[model samples]
Target chain A: MSRGDWASWLESWRQQLVLWLESTPAGDFVNTYTWAWPIAESFHFVGLCLLLGTVGLFDLRLLGFARQIPLPQLHRLIPWGIAGFSINAATGSLFMAAAPFQYLYNESFYFKATFLSVAGVNVAVFYLLFYRKIVPLGAGEQAPWPARIIGGVSLLMWIGVMCAGRLLTFYRPSFRFF
Target chain B: MDPVFIWLEQTALSVWVRESPSMFAFPGILTLHTIGMAFLVGLTSAFSLRILGFARRVPAPEMLKLVPVVWFGFFLNLVSGFLLLLAYPTKALTNPVFYLKLTTIALALLAVRALGRRVADLSFRPVRGWPGDRVLASLTLGFWVVSVTAGRFLAYTHSRLLASDF
Candidate 1:
């Protein structure tokens, strides 16, 4: 689709989000849940730390650091990583729910969401495409070249998500532009 | 405090950081600051959990080996953070939340170092039945999370934009 077509589609999404957001009262206690936003934001950051830390460690292993550690042993950390991701998704939704138009229309937020989705898909693809062959290969065996490539791509995609999320404030979309 | 602020503002790097017209001057530096935060906070949390015995199978020392990478991320954030402060010394210096963020980071770093040394002590293997490991792991994760969230709040809670305003 052309850029214009994509923009139009995004605009429709933004409109729907606006309607949903407006259904709530402007002074809704949920919006002003004094403790809630900061607490949720904290949880979100915690999740980011967990996700990045565990996943980054695994990627480093694939890239050949801590060669003595078994991949399965390292993989044990993945569940905690998933827990962190769950926290972020939950908190992120609250932020959007509180101010849908601000985020839905924001270019950086859009890019962040897009990158996150790509990273998620990449993780799924990594497991679906290579898990069985790699897992049975066992401890001390070098990761297959394909798995290493996947690991590298996963790292890049996550870092992209981080950068985009960080840059969100800088690229706040003008509400008037819509 | 005023004199100290004045002296800081007079520093050549601070002057450039505040006065430079290039995007690389302010906005670029801010972007780097946030990226560094993600890496630093993220890696710290991960390493903390590992140190606390979250993954008993992976050798604790092996997890400690990631320290250099975490430090690299920390350094990136430190430098970027300083640049951001230089750009608006008054903005950060006057903000209670900014100070809280700094203090939180300091505590988190200390916790990481202390935990790292403990984890490195090859004699200190995990006891199968003891809950010490789990408690330590939870504390490490908790501290890093608090630090990151406090850091995020700095943007929202600053008291002043410039010295002149105050």
Candidate 2:
């Protein structure tokens, strides 16, 4: 199909998806409670702190900032970061479930998803390509060039994620764009 | 204070922040505030985790390297937060939750300072079982939780969106 056709097709698909999402059980729960949405948002911000603190710190270590900390040891904080991500994923889903069309059609949602995917790919690259090689490095040692590069990319991607996430509300789709 | 909030809200900077259609205005400031919160709370949590013995092999003093990052996030939030308040002075100032958030942050920062002092004073010792240090770390973590929660609720609990709106 041509680009215009594809775009319109996707737009129609999104409208249908939004309608289905609005009928889900989670959507009802989120919309019915006066405080539920705000509470979920509170948890989301808290989770963000946890994720950034642990994951961002590890990234800094890779870039040679905290030279005295062992890489393996510092890596222990990753679970907390994962916990943060989990909280965000849950809360984020609730937001989408509450008003599917808002995010389904929002440009900022697309940016946030793109950044999130980039971060996922960066993590895969780190573990699949370089984790074994860089794991044995001790405190005060410089990570390999590849590790440093991964660290830099991870930082940028996560920052992009934060920026895009914050921009979500601003880009609530008005349905006119579709 | 009422007059002050009213006056502040009318300033060109504040008016632009509230009224501008550009994403660079309110949205950008909020984005900066959130990014800062993540780093500030996240880096601090890492230090607390170390004090609580999650990563025993990491020398405690080495974690001090992250203090600068914590400060960087804190300052970023301070500036961005001020801009947000400038944009909607009455909205935040009238909300009790906003004050709670500020108080929580102040305590959290103090906890951070206390933890940093203990970490700096360590003679490169393993920080596995220091009861006092652990307490400080735990308090810092708890305060950050409260701060983030209160900050989040500011959007929901505000009684007024503008000086005259209420």
Candidate 3:
């Protein structure tokens, strides 16, 4: 529970993770092939667009942008957003596997993870708590304050996730301590 | 071309874009570019999906209001993209992929504009008509994929980093 204990634990885990990941097939594929990295990066960009397009637009509607689109109707696009998220998750894991240290201690990566978590929790809350409430509302009707707040937060969180993700390379951590 | 790039690169704005330690410089501009891509491609993709019958309950007309937002995304990218180009005139100017990216973006913008009209008096049924809705939707999606991919490839494909390198 002390600072020293936590630091040591992190240090050991980082070493183990790096060692394990370096030996992975995903790691080998990425490391062996020249095109692997760029290919994955391309897919990652596409997936993010898909996500922001469907889900982000829905979020905008909830925030009263283009209020004419019915909430329930617009909700249909969430599945595509899920598909986009799935692609990114797969490619993102590959990236992290290929170069574990690039992300493990990077401040941008940490911020990205935090924003991703916030977005995830925000989605759950929207569906469980606010989704059904907005369902009955028809075209041009304004969403309740809760829905609007959730929408605003969702947008901000996604934008945060994106900004953090984009800044990952700029904030690559130094391994001098190791 | 090299002379112009050299001149541009030597400008204070371009220098800051390339060498500044501030996050608002290259890092922030790139982040803004990503956000623009998300919104530009995102809103249009949403509209395109609706056109493709992904969301049947939603009236296609209701979604047209968001087109301006899509344009807003394009505007953001245009400014951020120019700033990016300003930062590295030689890198982009020297690469064939850069031209591909610009052309692809131009095509994609056309597709977006055409879709606007095609969806104006839209119908869901398979009607034999001029520039089918599904076709335009598919084109928009396809053009975007190419543009986004080409945009990413621009980073790796550039042979020259600066005019001075020549």
Candidate 4:
């Protein structure tokens, strides 16, 4: 599709999806409870730490930064990173459902989603192409070139995601509540 | 309004940070601060977990290789945090939670340094006498949790957003 056509198509879909989200009970819950939103935000930050600490650290190791920490052993910390991602996904959904249009039409939100997708693809690429080759590598050994590229991409994508996420409030496109 | 804060709010740098329409001012600084928090807290917690014996096979001393990265995050935060404080002097200065956040970070770093020394003291043998190290690890973890919590609370708990608002 042409760029204009794609943009229009996304705009209509965003309108319809946001309308549906406005009717969700989850949205009402977040709006009704004063403390709920802030608490969830706190958890979101906490999860960010966990994800960056574990997964980001693993990425740095793959880039040959911490050579003595064995890759396979360090991989053990990834489950916790997954847990962090789960927390962020759950809390992130609440924010979206609470005011879908706020994000659906927001330019920064678009950037955030794009970066998130890139990060996901980076992970998929790593596991599919480089995981087997890099898994058995011992401490002090440099990861292969492909693995380093994935690691670098993972870090950049995540940082992009974070920047866009933080800019969401500033880029809300519409002033209407629903 | 307090004179210091009033003077601070009127200063060119602070005013630019708070009032400038440019995204690179407030939003960019805040984003950097959050990124730094993740690196500093995340790496520190990872090291703490290792010290607490979570990843037993990973060589403890080798983990210290991450110390410089952690410090990079720390310095990033220090600068970004100062910019934020300058942006809203009254808001952060008056809030008790802000002080608590600083204290928590200080304590956590102290714990991390002590633990680092303990790790460096190890001689590439099987780990031993780790009870104290574990205790320090737990303390560091607790401090970071509190620090992050306090930092998050500063937004809600602040009685004023600007000196004039109060």
User: Of the true interface contacts, what fraction does each candidate have?
Assistant: 0.62, 0.95, 0.89, 0.71
| Candidate 1 overall lDDT versus native | 0.73
Estimate, for each residue in A1-178, the C-alpha lDDT of model 3 and write its tens digit.
9999999999899889888987889988999998889889999999999999988988888888888778888888999999999999999999999998898878999899999999889889888987778878898888889878888998999999999999999998787846
lDDT of candidate 3 over B1-166, digit per residue (tens): 9889999999999999989999999999999999999999988887887777788878776678888888888999999999999999999989998998888888878887787776675543432224476787888888889889989988889898999652
Rank the candidate models, highest DockQ first. 2, 3, 4, 1
* Highest DockQ against the true fold, candidate: 2
Clashes of each: 0, 1, 1, 0
**Whole-model lDDT for model 4 versus the true structure?**
0.88
lDDT (10s digit) by residue, model 1, range B14-43 = 878878776577667776775666667776
Look at candidate 2 and tell me the lDDT of residue A55. Answer: 86
Which regions of candidate 4 deviate over 4 angstroms? Answer: A1-8, A176-178, B124-129
Once fitted onto the true fold, the runs of candidate 1 whose alpha carbons sit more than 4 angstroms away are A1-10, A24-30, A137-139, B10-12, B15-23, B127-139
| Best candidate according to TM-score | 2
**With candidate 4 superimposed using the best TM-score fit, by how many Å does residue B96's alpha carbon deviate from the native?**
1.2
Say which docking band candidate 1 falls in.
medium
lDDT of 2 by residue, B36-109 (tens): 89889989888888889987888878888888888899999999999999999999998999999999999999
For candidate 4, lDDT tens digit of each residue in A39-137? 888889889998999999999998888898889889888887898899999999999999787888788998999999999999999999888887888
Which regions of candidate 2 fall more than 4 Å away from where they truly are? A175-178, B164-166
Q: lDDT tens digits, residues A58-99, model 1?
A: 887787777777787788788888998898887777777777
Model 3: fnat (fraction of native contacts): 0.89
| Full-model lDDT for every candidate | 0.73, 0.88, 0.87, 0.88
